[model samples]
Target: MAKALIKYALTALLLCTGLAGAQAQESGSSAARKAVPKIQDGWLDVRAGEGQGRLPIHVSRDWSQAQPAVRRALIVVHGITRDDLLAGERAAAKVPSAADDAIIITPQFLIAEDVAAHQLPELTLRWGVDDWKAGFKAQAPAPLSAYAVMDAIFARLLDRQLFPNLQSIVLAGHSAGGQYLQRYALFGQGSALVDQAGVRLRYVVANPSSYAYANDLRPLAAGGFAAADASQCERVDRWPYSLSANLPAYARKPLDPAALMRRYLAHDVIYLLGEEDKDPHHPQLDKSCAGEAQGDSRLQRGRYYFAYAAQFPRDAAFKQRLFIVPGVAHNSTRMFGSSCGLAALFDEGRCTTEVAAP
Candidate 1:
């Protein structure tokens, strides 16, 4: 009887051990599934700046383990309401695996509320919005200065050693995000990543509502009311008039229209506009700054801006790459997918001869 009891006890112990091992294996698999996908080939989260905001940095390759033959990085900036992860995911989905050789970095900025709650007052005062002081006080602070946030992200990228073969850094932005990049590329000056890495930076302005131009508002040769010259007038002011007229005086403070034009002309910037986006009847068409300038229409102001830039000799080379994708609107996903063909242009290749008319 004693021998039989000992034998049963040993059998129960063996069963318990097997169950425990199975449970452990299941737990391990679950943990692996929960992990965030890496940025390039690996995604990890890092504090982008001093704020509570955490940016998900995705890497296509492990730069530490092995150096990639093509050392290129693309910095994608999200629009006003979106985050970096979504932007990166969208870009990754559209780009082919062959292009995966490049490292992609998507840095998220603090939300509007965070920014308004903490920094709005200071920004308002700095911009001399004393008249709107009471209104500003009621508003929240901004997350970070557009420039400061970008600088922090760039610093983090340099520290990561993720892109050992990093040669060129393409700054791509859409809509309001494009507006942010527009200002940053022009005024942010140079950073350590740019200087130390010998990074050649280029701007990809995709369907921005408005851009900071170095040119003044010039009236068409014929009055804006004439039918024969309607096309030229149509090109003159693509945004809604009300919003354009109501622009905060501070927004126009710099007043270097010609200089802004010259700067754009000299830069290697590409403007990607959607062809079907010329909807004057859209709900938001007449609202806000861009819409208000367009006589409340959703006409293609970005295209006009590209054409205007081409009129100048400095922008001749850039004018060749201006493109309008069919069957797309103010949608970033569609625009990115349509413009994927231009990926080669982003490489160390020469510009194509075909030019879209201004």
Candidate 2:
């Protein structure tokens, strides 16, 4: 009788204890679900005194969340005087890397009134026509260059405390933005820092008005190239065309032409051009005497640049490749959404320039 009573009491005690533990587990899950902060997608108040007191960078909501297991980043820059369009890029990057968590960033460069109204410090970089694209130092107050802004951006990302598991970053631009990418890829000083930290970076230049030529000569209409005669376009052989003439104070270190060209050719870069951006009379086209020296339209300029690079230094093994988005004009949406664009933005899908223009 004593043994039977002891066995029955032990069985009842175990059942009650298990029931209480189950209730506690359910309560813990409920508390965990409530702990996640409610997030709304918008801009970030970049706490820095560099530009405009505090830079207002448009960021994707996903960036607020943890980087998905894939660990990738895509930074999309807007064209000159364009409204905030980072939300678009965020969606585009997401489309291709559905399985991967990619954080998309679009840093605003020219915030004029916002800074003025707020009485914030003047730190944003600006230039005439396309001078900023060449990466010159700001004239007054702060001596930072547009390329310096890119450096600061990477510094924030490379902070292991912030993005501990980041693997790769893609820097891309369209139109004037593309112009920035091409030059920065070749000569930007900040890239070495990221490389040292063991993070990979790729440049995607899309539909820019021109390319930085290694020499003073420009391509002719009848299938050949020649030097820019002083009597013709005097400034053609300077800065953007060739590393000649007096550059801004920012380029304190004189770069050897031969060494610079070789270094540029070695980086991983993609030249993405749109087939339908062939209008010679586009309102925003670079029609200065120097721009005309390159080619008549965006398409012509890109083709000539690629051809020039390919035949340089006795046909050096080039790492740069040119891609064209079919039937796409000077439109950002179509360019990034195309198969070629998707391939550049994300490491998935095949890209080609053989498609016919629609």
Model 1 score (lDDT): 0.44
lDDT of each: 0.44, 0.63
- Which 10-residue span in candidate 2 carries the lowest summed lDDT? 31-40
For candidate 1, what is the TM-score?
A: 0.57
TM for candidate 2 is 0.77
lDDT of 2 by residue, 1-358 (tens): 5445443333322322323322321112232222112211333332223442224465553454444353677787666543435534644654746445667777655433334444545543333324456676544335456666677678767877667888888898887788777877767776888798999888888888767777775666666566665444545656665666655444547777657667777777777888999997675565555566677788888888877776667325676778888898887777877888888878667785633221
Best by lDDT: 2
lDDT measured at residue 58 in model 1 versus the true structure, 0 to 100: 47
User: Candidate 1 on 304-350: residue-level lDDT in tens?
Assistant: 45555566556345533565666778776666655442452244323
Model 1 misplacement above 4 A: 1-70, 83-88, 97-100, 112-143, 156-162, 191-197, 218-257, 281-286, 289-291, 294-299, 313-320, 339-357
Winning candidate number (TM-score): 2
Q: Model 2: residues >4 Å from true position, as ranges?
A: 1-54, 61-70, 87-100, 111-129, 139-141, 314-316, 354-358
Q: How close is every model to the real structure, measured as TM-score?
A: 0.57, 0.77
